[model samples]
Target chain A: MDKILKSLFDFQRFAGESALQSIITSVEERFPANEEKSPRTALTAEEMDQISAAGNAYLQMEKDKWENLVNGGN
Target chain B: MAVIDGEEVYLLYRDKVRGYISQHVNQREEVEDLCADVFEKVVSSLDTYDSTKASVSTWIFTITRNRVIDFYRRNREHAELPEELASTEMLDAGLLREETLRELAEALMKLSEEKRTIIILRYYNGLSLKDISDKTGISYGMVKVKHQQALKELKKIMKI
Candidate 1:
């Protein structure tokens, strides 16, 4: 029973991965033709600053939450 | 760069989360958005994470599954699914790998939200029954039964 279940699961994993790759490939192929030549675009300075700020905020929030929980705020 | 195991979790589970969203969501753009949302939720909820109850991958899947359910609920109220999805072409199980996946996805889309979620968590995420139960707040016994039923239903839909 376990072996059968495992086999079925393995097949399902293969099927799911194949499906995801298909979706990603299809989406990649559908990118704007003009944009294809410059697939890699640089983040603007302001956009990079915003990303960095968001990352820092997220890290701080995680730290604060963990600290509170550990300190019996749960 | 290093902060109390954040990088390890990201490196370990990022692809798994993306794959989960891609397999379960309808649109490619939504998949990308939901993948980011899943990680954001994961980051925020990291304090509550209990490794003893479930692995990080299973935790991520739980978040993705809930988000997909919410998407369906919102969309079902506003739009009708494409009719092509209801046809036998979308049920084919032996098409090329890519096409078959699309068919499998279509089949999954036809299932109830609960059923689709259980199937994805159990099969696609490789989560154990107990882990699924812990993540979903369902019982272990219920997870086993639901998983069995979900697979049976999927197999029937795929005609496999």
Candidate 2:
């Protein structure tokens, strides 16, 4: 009797856990990070090439981005 | 492919991330700090980031959401609001579902500590009943009963 009861409870616990995980997954899938309509102002080909050239030597994207943000004054 | 700079990502994502985090926290100031942390993580993780898997914004916001959850864990004692519930935009069923989930999380908080612990162990941690019983030092039958009771309480809480 003891073993049978434990087995039943064990099953219940497994099902419950699975359900919770699904609910959690559902919630995540339902929400997204951004709803922005437009992309950022386009990087000109020259600007892109400059970033690319700098990248070949050193200027990482992070630095370029920060510079742009500062320059853009936002 | 030009790597996305953290600033560009932060500039584009700041508002969305702020909106999402604000749902969890009451303070306005901390949101900016958390946004910075999220961007910092983005910069550090950029090499491994894959656009194929998720949009860049989605990826950053996921980090932002996680930082908020961590903040809550470190600062708040009874906070059970999961990061998944942070959407400000409404879905067709969004309002009611959000409220129910919020209440459900709080309801879990309202359960007896033991019952709440079992449910979290079994559900949140995805532990098997046997594992939970072993971990908590409770008998298997008792763990099952507590978890079942907790679920019932969660349902009752949601219903009301």
Candidate 3:
């Protein structure tokens, strides 16, 4: 129940990028944007590449750990 | 078969993840670190993901939100976390669908104008009831009551 409520509240961000834009358009049509800032923009491609590298490295480390455990540190 | 492709998922939702994180955390480095953490968790939990229940987008965002909430809990920089995000229960994958959001939007449309605005301000904008009162010129107590009433109406309408 609370989870549903939280997801509903988080719809703006949790709906993902394209869907969020549509929701904003639908809502803003009813209530005009005043002083509030528009929703935050998505991260840039370059930034994403850097993070992707880091994330892939972490995955590799985990994979290595599993293999080592299976091999009993041989 | 591989449960999920880590790099593909990272490429797909990285923007959404960082956008959500930047709302709560300002430092660029911390934002990138948190984004990486979300993907790592995605990879680790890939086998557990049940796509029939929730879209990958919904699942990733749930993890992303929890990461932000955890960050705030650890640092206490925000003074107080929004109760909506603070006490979020374990992800109930079935209920966190994109359709639920559409239903919520439709439900908000049914609400009176004042109630709708209060709900959006409190949740979408992450404003507190008192902050809402200050901004809208409503008394604090009135704002609090309306916020609760709005939630109750939403629950009934969404049949949650």
Best by lDDT: 3
- For every candidate, how close is chain A to the native chain A in TM-score? 0.46, 0.26, 0.45
lDDT over C-alpha atoms for residue A19 of model 1: 52
What CAPRI class is candidate 1? incorrect
TM-score of chain B of 1: 0.45
Ranking by lDDT: 3, 1, 2
For model 3, the DockQ equals: 0.15
TM-scores of chain B, in order: 0.45, 0.48, 0.75
Off by over 4 Å in 2: A1-74, B82-160
Residue A60 of model 2, lDDT score = 68
Every model: Cα RMSD to truth: 23.7, 26.3, 20.9
The better candidate by TM-score, 1 or 3, is 3
* B1-160 per-residue lDDT for model 1 (tens digits): 1122656776777776677556556689987888778778877878787765554544555566566656655688764432222221233222323344566667767777666666656543556778667667778898788777777877787776
Best by TM-score: 3
Q: Against the true two-chain complex, what DockQ does each candidate achieve?
A: 0.04, 0.01, 0.15
Model 1 Cα displacement at B84 (Å)? 20
* TM-score, one value per model: 0.35, 0.35, 0.63
Model 1 chain B is weakest, by summed lDDT over 10 consecutive residues, at B84-93
